[model samples]
Target: MKRALLILAATAVVSAPALADEALAKAKNCMACHSVDKKLVGPAYKDIAKKYAGDAKAADMLATKIQKGGSGVWGAIPMPANPQVNDAEAKKLAAWVLSLK
Candidate 1:
């Protein structure tokens, strides 16, 4: 039973991309402006995911936007550039955002 529980825990960890990415987002201060389900200073992440649901290039575009920042896309409030997050982290964040239900 203990071995089975351990395997289940490992499986959960392996499958929980959103959980891991939420931690990354929090660490990178994304939660300051964006939330998974509701709008904050910025649009909700699930909304972003819904908007880009079918776009194949969304990941790359969003990653670039995260690093460089943009305005007039979602609203009048501009998204500030995140120089603290590297390219890889931006990509991961984009992927995670896009994965939201």
Candidate 2:
């Protein structure tokens, strides 16, 4: 029981950041057009991570795209600019999206 409890605690600690980021994404309405694994209106977070893999400037670029919005890269559907999301939150979301496997 003690070992199980320890494992559960460790799992929670390891998973907390992803959960927090997901909550932030949802709060920011990112979920309306995107998802973690599968493609939605926007590309999946994991697909974004794959496309930007090893790109040193991906976080900055993605953050800018998040705030200003863009099209032609993903599809015909343009992503609307999110004026409500500040620079910091955009960066955080970008980092989180890039972190997805």
Candidate 3:
């Protein structure tokens, strides 16, 4: 029973990030505009990774940009401001977005 409990704890720890990302996505209302593979109002995650490839600062830059909201880079369709997204969540989303490459 103790070993089973340990395993459950480990699994919870490992799954936390995925849950956080899912929650963050929902909280940020990402589904209304962007997707991991296909273009919506904004470019796809794959396209973002492709554009910012090789840049070490992509996470930082993207996190800030996502929080503040911007446009012209991904076309005239302005990305809506996401003040609801915290810095940690933004960073995770940015990393996940870049990872979609």
The lDDT leader among the candidates is 1
Summarize candidate 3's per-residue lDDT along 1-101 as a digit string, tens digits.
99999999999998787667756776779867887779988888789989998899999999998899988898888887899988888898988778664
Alpha-carbon lDDT, every model: 0.96, 0.94, 0.84
In candidate 3, which residue pairs get closer than 3 Å at backbone N, Cα or C atoms, i.e. clash?
none
**Candidate 1 runs further than 4 Å off:** 1-11
- Model 3, position 9, has a per-residue lDDT of 100
Question: What is the Cα-based lDDT of residue 64 in candidate 3?
Answer: 91
lDDT of 2 by residue, 23-97 (tens): 989999999999999889999999999999999999999999998999999989999998889999999999999
Worst 10 residues of 3 by lDDT: 18-27
lDDT of 1 at 32: 99
Report the C-alpha lDDT of model 1 over 46-72, residue by residue, as the tens digit. Answer: 999999999999999999999999999
Best by TM-score: 2
Candidate 1: clashing pairs of residues: none
Off by over 4 Å in 2: none
